[model samples]
Target: MINRRTFTALMAGTLAASGKSFAETARGKTVFYASVGTELFLYDVDAEAAALTRRSSVMLPAGVQYAWPHPSKRFFYVASSNGQPGGGAVNQGDKHYASAFRVDPATGALTPHGQTLALTARPIHISIDGGGGFAMIAYNDPSNLTVYRINADGTLGALVQQRAKPDIGIYSHQIRTTPSNKTAILVCRGNNPADGKGEDPGSLKVFGFNEGQLTNLASYAPGNGYGFGPRHLDFHPTLPFVYVSLERQNKLYTYGLQLDGTLSRDPLFMKDSLGEPNNRRAGQGAGTIHVHPNGRFVYQANRNSAVVDFQGKKVFAGGENNMAVWSIDQKTGEPTLIQTADGHANQLRTFGIDPSGRMLVAASISPILMREGNNVANLSAGLTVYRIGGDGKLSFVRKYDVDTSKGTQFWSGMVSLG
Candidate 1:
């Protein structure tokens, strides 16, 4: 049943790869928001290099802020970041608006689902528990948090819980789910800063969840010294450890996870102080925090710090740029800075580290100086690949040809927490 055209096409591919230069593949059902517009692409991880492919292109209703993928990869929900359809800003003093979209995994397209009228204030981030039964949404416009039980067909059910004032705001940044899948954590920045240099510092809050219901558990308020501004947090792939990124102080903290489903303050926390850039230390910021798969080190995007390296298990105050490197103190579970990663912009949204903690993929939430010959013109956004050596040093791999417009300025992340 083989046709001539099909045979010719197979032969052409085989002949083209006669000797060297082979194509690699990726594994896992990966999804990321095509922030600028619609059309979400999928990545299937194989073994070595990731094979670029599309499961489907979703044409959203436009202005779709972010999407939450189903753990089964069978569905996802897209939400409005600004206002709802027919129009109304997500934030208008005391008002709130948000919309949802149903995703068809088989075809890779999005369909309008429902709208929440005056439900949430500037609803931005959404988190689904590991059990795949419930969802928690962070409404920053009104500094609130809400949870909803999901129906089998993807329609949201009753609004089981709602807490209007989260207290801390410049901007309620993120809501995260813990490994136990029983707790949802919220991290946020100060109100919209008119100056942009980043003021006020952020805070962290944890809410207990059960059978799709939420219970206010515990929260962290950053006092003076530590500069409380917390952003993204990454759970270790192997250890019972969690890493949090501090924006105002441009620092990192490794929190030891407790058995009762909370964070422990045992050895206090691991610290890494990013160095100055062009002698300007005040503006140096931090974004996302991610731990290497090895459980031996940690990484954070130290903005404008150039790169900071100190004793990840002990020292700080000096180092280099790109990626802030560190070593984990096994006995105390604290971090000691090792070296500064040398790469593009310090505006890394978050990084994906391999299971071995040996290879890495970093995305620039902003601009980055591209390596020679790897420049894809205006460089749109940077995707730098790297290798974490045995000594814990990060070596650059390759940067992809990208469209910088993909960078999210008005929005936080163009990705799903899954």
Candidate 2:
């Protein structure tokens, strides 16, 4: 068995030998961004201290849904829309856009790079291929995917029309390209049965990709995807393993990443994500899953924002709202639950880990009121920071409360400074 020090050294050496340009640029500084409504704010991160200092800000055309950085670390892509949840007459809104930004390597500031591409619907997630040649966007309402070329100058190019109508399952949440850049996976989180509606099965849509064009390859939906609702997935850094966060079931699934970019038909292992595995409640779900840079650990967010009417006011319905930490077995790629650290807020919609894997910052979407004995206390939306230990555990460091009156703290993530 490899020791912690030896494993870390090996991972570092492998990264150096790979000579990834982003790693070279990220050697010294780390920056973070958080979006509230149409404005995106930047922060400087001190990983050792587990603190964040607000820096600059930029505005998007609408509320920011998600963002991804180019492999070169010189550009960033953002998706924005005026749409709100609950599809039908509940305000679908009209405007949707995908914008590109040029990253200032030295200061980690952003400026508009290319013309914004108008999207047909609100983009739920956006990702760039490993080669940084194309940007893939996923829409939820109609469940669709779009590919746009990334210009040499790091600008958004025209959409690449696909001749194959791949089956994009219900409520697509995320789209990502495989490490080989030869295939892509779309995470479709089918809706759970509600209001006399039947359960819409979820699926992982795999496609063969070439020159920004995608062809249908495979769709993996165990048990016809009745109770499976995967929100996000992350690949192991050095192992042929993929970890998926099941949003609806509050579970973590491990799958083998095949040579051809398809996943194993059945999960290799599955584990409960919640600390109280038996106490499942409405609105209790998993948000994101990410593997540590050293490949020794995986982290996921468990969120619960369910509310109940009490004394003519909405009050927090207690449930799990924290980060679930898992220790990965290096040899077999199995994960064991180790810790469930408190998030200290409601609706942890997103979070980011520093490139060095020394710190993690989670963002809560909005404030919530919880009944404490006879009185109610307000839990404000904020950015919670934690210090990562050598054993892949997290220690609570500090939290910076954010003002979300203007809009929810919708999205936040870390980006290595180039």
Candidate 3:
């Protein structure tokens, strides 16, 4: 196994051989990280030119589900598990953990920083407080959340003992801390309408945060949480607005953030995320959402990569697999659909925009068999890069394919170097 000192030395040698010092090359550049199976890759991204180059890769003990960087940009946390995403449910397993890594400020290289902590259930999402004081992990199978303190050296401490159990609703997908560092929000995506099974209402669970303890604050749901399957949410950089992506309803909603760190009772505006909203298909639903760095635009993904039998062979079902671009009004916090860019591949599970807001990269999770004009071909897993214009519209630049046959490209994000 490669230790922290060895990895740092190897990165320094690599930079020296290329005649580029780490301090000179990595200051303002953004690095894109993707977790494919057990391996994590670092890609050097060019915002002005809209291109990406894979730099290095490191393997984890298990398959990665989610990752979040520290507020200081000096550390990163990853949740891994032996289980995988089944056809319609999560494949259960015993191995689950949260690992801390030290991120090199000048080189973007990641090295193991502390002891890996064992988790009772597979964590679906992980995030840190804005003050970098605590690490929060959310599990969906049992619907639980855990908190770990951050040591002075940036390593993770033991789990904080909880005095009260907050009501973490069913199927929690994402967790985030508010800008004030006084509140935490969990997006609970309820079960979709299925055969002979009634719909399970979804909700946004909010809690008050003080130091490392949590107190249940409020629960916000439209129409008593029915028909409100929220998968992910992103807050505006300078406004009191929260944008959410409804996974089951294929819609986007905007909510007003109150002064006391609680969300409003109802949504301020709701809009369809699909291009052909009236023509609903079988596998059409929303995926991830992100707000632009400038706060002038918001982006969400619509994925429908279901392969079905066609002409006695399995092929694409021909539904929408694209990214929706919405221009945000600064005054009223309303979002309007400007364009829907084709994702070139299938099932874009996650994506990230650079801090400069000049480039966007979308990750297509798995490969699928699709019909290309009359011939059927296997579309490999890949990452698509786009150039963001001045008006917040995205233009396709290029795509780099990956071999995800071993495991899926589960999560991807971009972090700025310190």
Candidate 4:
């Protein structure tokens, strides 16, 4: 028997099958996309079945580092570079850029839309404002931020110049604007502890937003930002709270949003993201984070894809590789860990939940050699899909493997058909 959500999807598919224009399709239908190196792969997502079918792929100028969909849902911005992961350059030339693509409403096919803007450095993160009028980008190496105007034709325009400020924190990981479009926050994941080096402090740099111009507001951190390494953050859909993922410490923190466009000086709540918090392990850190669209749950990725040499063979270092599901207390904005679903693959770098809050897709970036008993083999990169339950839990549905020998699967996201 077809349930309500499935029934709605069937009706929408039926209308599209009956020759309805692609633009006329229901806006609730969703499709997923992943960036594997310089290639972009599109998928048709089934919300009820929690499945994905590969559609096609498109090529970009260089390797994809990050991507952001416009608020209009009709366009997407992709940042590409030749730089490889870790502390070195790939020497593919410094031809880094941010390109725009047109989204085909029905099939999720992408076509180049406008001129690709040359970027000064690799963009660690990029996001469009709530109003879809500006594209805000964050760079990591020598941290900086820039805002570009979204042209009337859905293209990108020149950068909006602003006064130089010394408050931009180190290693900016993500940048996002508030729903109210009055504030912008940059998540800076300061350096981790290294040999003969002390750990660098991290903080959330807040700015006052006015038509893409950012004015320094405040930097919120605990104990002068020491021992705090925030990588990503997501705002509640309806509440004045924010969920942040701490990369270096493998924890989650919640902050209250003040009306003056600043965050609480200290976290209102702090929770461990690991399944076994007491049993410490090496090569464990938090990745991307997303709040459920309905504001009832929060999800974060726990990754451990690093390998260690065992008996002269490079084998997977055992660590948690799963999605941590946390139930949100709507009244107070606190989160409780409810479930940790195995992501099937290692190192889930990024993931996305559908706008309707019914489906989730996770992308595992790279493959590593795993030891199964005495035999060892390479685990391929893949994407996992799950169905979100009413209680804010996740039920694993299926996994789609992709050959990452050519390039890594850096990022993936679900875009609703407009």
Best by lDDT: 2
Candidates in order, TM-scores: namely 0.68, 0.94, 0.92, 0.91
| Residue runs of model 1 more than 4 Å from their true location after superposition | 1-34, 37-39, 44-47, 50-56, 62-67, 83-119, 163-170, 191-201, 224-226, 265-267, 273-282, 304-321, 354-358, 366-379, 388-392, 404-418
Ranking by TM-score: 2, 3, 4, 1
Model 3: per-residue Cα lDDT over 135-239, one tens digit each: 999887767888999998889898999899888998888988876678899999888768888888889999998897888999988878898999999987666
Candidate 4: give its CA RMSD in angstroms. 7.5
What is the C-alpha lDDT profile of model 1 across 99-168, one tens digit per residue? 4456555434556565543454556666666666766677555466666777776666677644433333
RMSD for all candidates, in order, please: 13.8, 3.7, 9.6, 7.5
lDDT of 4 by residue, 313-354 (tens): 889889889999999986678899999899899899999987
Native-referenced Cα lDDT, model 2: 0.88
lDDT of 4: 0.84
Question: Per lDDT, what order, best first?
Answer: 2, 3, 4, 1
Residue range 1-418, candidate 2, lDDT tens digits = 2345544554454344335643444476789999998999999998878899999999999999999999888999999999876565465679999999999988789999979999999898999998899999999998899999999999999889898886799999999987667889999999988899999999899999899989999998888998999999998776677899999999999987776667788898999999999988888999988888778999999999999988777999889999999999987689999999999999888999898888999999999999988788899999999999999998999889999998888899999866
lDDT score at residue 343, model 3, on the 0-100 scale: 95
Worst 10 residues of 1 by lDDT: 17-26
lDDT of 2 at 206: 93
Off by over 4 Å in 3: 1-27, 86-90
Count of backbone clashes, every candidate in sequence: 30, 0, 0, 0
